[model samples]
Target: MFVGHGLGAFALVAFLATVAGCSRERAIQLGIVAGLFAFVPDVDIVYAPIGLLARSVQTVSPDVFWGTANTVHRGATHSIVIGAILAAAVAAWNIPARVSRIAAVGGFLSIIAIGAVVDGLVNAGVLVVYVATGLAIGEWARRKRSSTGWLFGAALIGLVSHPFGDLFTGGPADFLYPFDIVLVTSRIALHPDPTVHLLAVFLLELGTIWLAIVAYTRLQRISIRRLLRPRAVAGSGYAAAVFVIPTPTIHTAPLFVFSILALAIVGVGIPAHPFARHRRSETLVTGLAAVTVGAIAYAAAYGTLG
Candidate 1:
């Protein structure tokens, strides 16, 4: 859910919106908005920097990337109701285009600022001042129209999608602000969780990646095979690496993961022929990738874990 939230998530959403109505080029532009806004909710992490330099940090963790102000990681902006409000506001107002530009800039800076906190590289109240300055300037921009549907759509997609991405990584999103309602509850355990049952989460991420690829490629008239190749190669390659890695202690049986992976690869091949008509290479590559996943999972099972 790391890159899944940023690049893959926003891009996939942008691609889908493009297919919905807007022109491809316009959709791409809106995608820029989606990508930026997707990170906006996390901007509150700026408080992490403010606290550290002031030596009176408002947040407990100071782990800005995951920290929040006066509350938890998923705060107000992460709220669905809040996001809806923001999105609606974006649609309803004819604000200066610069507001978005500065917001996007600040949003990314905020992420970087959070990273700095995580790395412990920040001090002297400098980072706090820096981000604050940027945001402040962004707020003072010039204004335009509310008739365009693009802003609303982009805002809605970006704002709403951000929380769902968090579900696969951390706690559930608080969709209803001030009501204490958790919109998403299941954060299916995965590898990083220090558990043996990593298959479910891994498969979920794999499936998410696949969905993004399939949906976007189809929408853009890009052959699905085009997107699948590199992924298969990469998966197969990683499988190869894992298959040869040194063993670790307390490994759990990953046979099921491998078996399912192998089956999935062959499945990809079967579907390719009907879709692309005699595209044997596509099936072969996919099948090979599947074998790779199977091989990796099988070997990994015997390697290490709790």
Candidate 2:
């Protein structure tokens, strides 16, 4: 559910941002901090979307919500400039003069209770961590300049890191919109070319998943080499199985073994771990990688919505 056409690869972006944020000292904590706000830019999805009834209604496409972003999903909101603006707002606003750990804990639980929104159910703990980090940072950035700078720094890291996730699927985000113009695009086409799109998505997910696996393995104190062997067996087996399933296709789906084998072979190179050596800061490097595989497989097997 947290996965999308790089649209909601917030986990991957959060993973990288956390690594650069606080080192291993606050890896898990800051990772959760960044993860919570990483997808806020997409909150613009509610512009014309049904409020609480969205899930029940199941409107196939959220037309206006995305259209507000200049007729695209990654419009004005996706801009690094907009991200900075948001960061400024957070910095300038008098959020809470002082927050106690007790208050933060209460707020964290409240946020989880309110997790009826998209992407909320899966990652509500992010909200909890975000507040916890904010409290910690607020104490550290006590000086006016330091406070503003740290606020700006963390927000910028969370906001700007996301559009690169969009690079895997849609047209590239316009990093510098009104001030200067630069539109990003992926060499791997998103849709029209279904096979190529799936291929690109598989690679993108593979990279992110590998990072998470390495980080998680280290965090759990599990040996990376031992971890990969089982995961490799599973992942490689899944890749191989993809071809054998009687999945639908435009052609004779039953006789599509060769095509499936080729697809699986492409995947065989995808490793259980992408790194030859996991870094010393392994705890900070990851979160939520395997979830995307299910979403990707469903889209590939089911084909386009139309």
Candidate 3:
């Protein structure tokens, strides 16, 4: 879902921009801006390594490891309130008025102070990273000569749309944050069976990535389907893992993910003509196709066998 966050945002913004009469180049640029900011909320993941390092015993299951890593992942940074404040800060900072700039800085600092009081010094440090990210993006947008409103809209769309993606994978995000409200109380269940549910979520993620790829290829006037190589069929072999590995659920998918992704090697394996000019794109497209094929094969096998 990490990659999905940026790609999904990119697809949505880019497609809409195209429909709304923006030129291809300009639309791609706006999509890229939104995609970059979309990654900002996940900065809380920086705390994961710290959490892991502080542990007395490092040996842990996938569930425990990720549980520890995501301790602060869906908190303040995922909040729409925090996102709005950050977007406003970016907009205010872009204003030419001295008073507006001063207010932006002051408002940002005050938010940091509030975070410190509420979440403590360590989490306050995370807030600093978050605010710094928003400000840096603001500076980049300013350098690009984007209007404040456009930048604000990009930032808001990226930040606001992010937490919603989490509802399908993990605990619901603290969408309101700094407040105790719980808008979504549980992960959305796609199916009654755990395995089927995981497969549904996995397919959804793949669909999102495919959407981004389609949008990008369309913008660039490239044919994504034409880039594939026969090597992609190799990915279907991953279906065998259904019989060998333990059944994977959302909480225990490390093995399934690692094994399936390993099939990507088939794509980049020695080509008939290694030095072909289009080899890179061919291999990349094949790799993605392989993964897609592997997932579908696994899902099919799972359904048939059970």
Candidate 4:
């Protein structure tokens, strides 16, 4: 759920960057909505006891809140069908005349997906019920009104990625929903390499700061766009290695260090290269810089070989 939320937020930023023009106020608004929406699905714990109590009264059995909460994955709320239906209903009632239909669709889908993720998979049990409830409320009150395809796409990506992120961290989101098979991690973990973990953490922090700077500059209309292609290059390198490396391990300090350096070098070189002819140079540069940090972190966890 944590990883999914972060990705969703990142997706929101990317989508906003393209559509909303990436203003500070808009970013803040998106952040707030994303945070609330991300956790909206897990609100089902409130109903577990109710169901249990009802059963107990009807069948002369005892009810346990914890037990009720610990079970129940995807019954109704988590399904894409239900999500769409609920989203449509909400839109019918709440959408403003001035807002774009696309933005409203995106927002509704995003929240509904969040509910599904939280209820059905991200956190196991009766959480789905609560998520459905939240979805109902959120749908009723929803009004931000982006109503665009880009927004919905971003939100959808975030919703889908949430459980995948949790799989890596060994979270129960995968098991939260009994039938769905989504495994992911938050990408933050105890490094397979101790030294690399520490180093990677530091580099990630720096990268975050750098990204903030770039975003701020963009808001200020500064032309010094960040580079991102280098990150793509690093990703390519990593993909290539996956096939070549016989044994898989996260303790790749050398790879992390080298990737970082490669990203940095590439990032610095981008400005002078012909590829930098575009107006969004700063965006690319920032992306590359961030990739460099990712490489560093990977190296810390799984030291590079050769």
Candidate 5:
């Protein structure tokens, strides 16, 4: 899922948290943490070299290490046990403060932990061990005297939304990772083939960018600068991530249509919702736009190279 989607959810949580026990600063902090930590499960991709090495080790000794590490969304890294450890450590290290420092730290930790575990579950569903571990930690976190419920809510939103977003692309999420049952999208037609793949990706990516613009425009009407900062940061990050990756080929007609719709949405819809605290619609639109553009550019480049 695009970080904007996650951030949009986090923004909702943060907004609600502000109405609850958390101060504005704390709520924003939680959103920041949630947005950043939501990317945790993806870290496995960064450690691909380790996964390759582990695959070799598994071939040598399958009984001991179990070859899960070689798979992107498997093992202890995505386990609840690791989540709990992270939550506990964060809570313990929290500096003493009157405003429930432990709660803040613990909340952020749990969100990160759970997000990682659930990411695997969304993909292959075989990640039961990880989910169980995460749930146990969640139970423990829930029992705390100083609980930041909003963080958990944000995490849940992040976990669930990711898989749903991937559905648009029809990519398999490995929802049943550690489990015997695995679920991939039954609807294969939506999945990007090399031919129209770039077109679809361009639509999604451009949509996200448009949504961010909408979000910013909406925030500007209310004159809340802080509310727009995360969107900017997320937008910049998305741009950076896309820039580093190769571009895909996109269909000109679809791209043109998507761009027009995006402009319309940003220009007309956002200004109408000046006081809206959450910009989910905008976020989703922008995310879709970005992915669409990205897929197209990537496909085109690959096609040319091949």
Candidate 6:
């Protein structure tokens, strides 16, 4: 899901940019900027280490560690209001240097101030890191000389779309933070059965990654379908895992995830020739296709048996 966030943003923005008449190189650059910004909200995960270090016992289970660390995971950073402000600040970088500095500083401080008022100083400290990350990405876009409108659009789309993706996996994000409004109260259920729901989400994530891959190939003027190999079909064998592993839910999915992902080994059977120009790319495309096939096969088996 973490990688899905960045890649999803990249795919959407890059495709839109291409359709909007941007040069291929310019579209790719804008997409990269948006993809980076899409990762800013999750920076709250950084709190995991700090929490672990402060504990009397050094070790904790995965659930305990994540629970402790994610206290502020979907807070102010996910807010559309906050995202808009950051986008504006980033876009301002195209203006005079002094005004740009003022906008960036002012936007950063304003977010911290809101966080302090709403969630307390500790969470506000987290906001500081988050704001810095957004600004750093904005600065990078500025250096790339991205147009003001394009920069703002990329930032806004990337930051804002992130929260929606979360709704499908866990608790809803605070879409309107510091305002005491709850837009969504629960995770969006894709299926009635827990195992099926988890599988659905997993397939959705794989689809997103594939979309990003297609977008990349388009930018490089390559045909993704042609790069894939017959070995990918071997992934269908993963359906056998349905009979062996315990049923998986969103909360307990490591076994299912790991087992299905192991099918990626099928992609390694590439040309051994040293002079094969597209060998690396072919292997990667083949691997992704394998994983995609495996997940679908597993889902179909689970649906039939369970």
- RMSD in order of candidates: 10.4, 11.5, 2.2, 13.1, 12.3, 1.9
Q: Per-residue CA lDDT of candidate 6, range 1-306, in tens? A: 788889999999999999999999998999999899899889888887788777738568888788877788888888888888888877876566896778867877888999898889978888889888887898788888888899989999999989999987888998998788899999999998899899899989999998998998989899987888998999998888888988889998988888888887777784575236757788778888999998889889987886
Query: Which candidate should be chosen as best, given TM-score against the real structure?
Result: 6
Residue by residue across 11-57, what tens digits does model 1's lDDT show?
66567666677666555556656555666666555655555556554
Clashes of each: 3, 1, 0, 48, 62, 0
> What is the overall TM-score of model 4 with all chains considered together?
0.39
Candidate with more favorable, higher TM-score: 5 or 6: 6
Q: Give the alpha carbon lDDT tens digit for every residue of 1-306 in model 4.
A: 333344344545544654656555566445444434444444544556666766575543223554564454323333343334434533443544545446545544554465456554433334334435434544433555544343343333333434343333222444223345543324556566545444545455455445544554555466552334434454334434334434333344344445444554444444455344563564445555556545554453355542
> lDDT of model 3 at residue 38?
88
Winner of 4 and 5 under lDDT:
4
lDDT score of model 6? 0.86
TM-score, per-candidate, Cα-based: 0.52, 0.48, 0.92, 0.39, 0.42, 0.94
Better of 2 and 3 by lDDT: 3
Worst 10 residues of 6 by lDDT: 270-279
Point out the higher-scoring one by TM-score: 4 or 6: 6
lDDT of 3 by residue, 1-306 (tens): 888899888898888779878889877877877888889999988887778778848676556567776777888889899888888888899998999899899868866876788788887888899999889988887887777776777788889999998888888998998888889999999898988988888888888888888898889898987887888998998899899999999877878878887877776877786437768766767887899899999999999999
- Which structure among the candidates has the greatest lDDT? 6
Ranking, TM-score, top scorer first: 6, 3, 1, 2, 5, 4
Alpha-carbon lDDT of model 2: 0.45
Q: Kindly report which residue stretches of model 6 are placed more than 4 angstroms away from their true locations once superposed.
A: 270-277
In model 5, what is the error at residue 246, expressed in angstroms?
A: 12
* Residue 149 of model 4, lDDT score: 41
